[model samples]
Target: MQGPARAVQPDEVLKDPQLETRARDLSKDLRCLVCQNQSIDDSDADLARDLRVLLRQRLVAGDSDAQAKQYLVDRYGDYVLLKPPFKTTTLVLWLGPLVLLLCGIWVAVGFYRRRGAAQGETEASIPLNEAEQKRLSKLLANERKR
Candidate 1:
């Protein structure tokens, strides 16, 4: 009889159901190195299957969830974990957007200040000439009538 296709292959299942469950959960948080975007649990790649076996082995060998995940991280350089720990290597990934936003704001503020300076020299600080003042008054009078 054919059995169901499983994310955790039948042969890789641990004798202890509890440990197998832990392995399954851990697998969901592990990135498949081959697929890049898929978790080991969801990937059908050979590398993902190997990772699943390795995870089950680790759990059966008495490693806690954190220790098992750390073991994979150590072997694969943190890229194997879907959510990598915050550290020097990932600092830019964590802070890059905020840093870019601050830089943009600083640049925009400087540009605005320069624009204000240019505008000040043009007409912002100057009194209107008599002809311009008379034209403005006539326009205002026409607006009041409307």
Candidate 2:
């Protein structure tokens, strides 16, 4: 047998399919105030249910989705939007990935350039000193033995 959720969910049959569609779209884009990581559409929290009802009421009262969302944003700030508008205030959030990507590319290029420059440097023309010659001879002997 199914659980209690299977009953209450079906009981709230949306009278208008268009309203239901709009509600789905709006809820999916709205972050749940209680469960900050979840959208209202995906949250079972009481606050999520309340927000759903509020959105439906606003829609029925002829408020477009944008207006309803703006109302919520005005009340709760941009955190209410799961995907907020890319404006001056949120420019860091919008451009952060690209900025990080460019930095990574620049660092990689710098590393490669440094590596090439280091490789281009000439090896010492002089022979190894006494201690260095002993170490090198031991190392060569070990390698040959291996």
Candidate 3:
């Protein structure tokens, strides 16, 4: 059985089959304000239902699909769009992850380089003096006694 939250409702169905189809398609492309992650069509929120009705009204008023979508986008901003267009305002949304990844890689590389330099300094070819060798031997002898 279909769940209570079906994408389209019978009561909201349009008389014109073609317009109904267009409205359904448009609804699927709209993000639900309340659900955030779900399309308006798939969401059970009251806001989603209101938006669906508004979409149908636009279609019934002879608005083209593009016009209707633009109307909603203008009122709600690009957040209402399920797939936002790549425009100047949304450029950061599209590239932010790549920018963060590159930054993380740069930080990791610098950390490793500094760590390697420290390691190289500690592993240098300097030889220990005789006094230091004798101190080490004395420490080892004390350890063995303990």
TM for every model, in the order presented, reads 0.63, 0.61, 0.71
Clashing pairs in 2: none
Question: Which candidate has the top score in lDDT?
Answer: 3
Mind giving the per-residue lDDT tens digits that candidate 2 earns over 1-146?
A: 22223212453435777877787778788998889988887788888777778887888888998898888789888888999889998888799999999999999999999988776664545567999999999999999998
Native-to-model Cα distance after best TM-score fit, residue 93 in candidate 2, in Å: 1.7
Best by TM-score: 3
Candidate 3: pairs in clash: none
- Is 2 or 3 the stronger prediction by lDDT? 3
Which residues of candidate 3, in runs, are more than 4 Å off?
A: 1-5, 119-146
Residue range with the least summed lDDT across 10 consecutive positions in model 2: 1-10
Candidate 3 least-lDDT 10 residues: 1-10
Tens digits of per-residue lDDT for model 1, 1-146: 12323566778777776787787778888999999988998898999999988887888788999999989988998789788778999888679989999999999999999999999888777899999999999999999999
* Candidate 1 deviant stretches above 4 angstroms: 1-6, 101-141
Ranking by TM-score: 3, 1, 2
lDDT preference between candidates 1 and 3, better one: 3
Full-model lDDT for every candidate: 0.85, 0.79, 0.89
lDDT of 1: 0.85
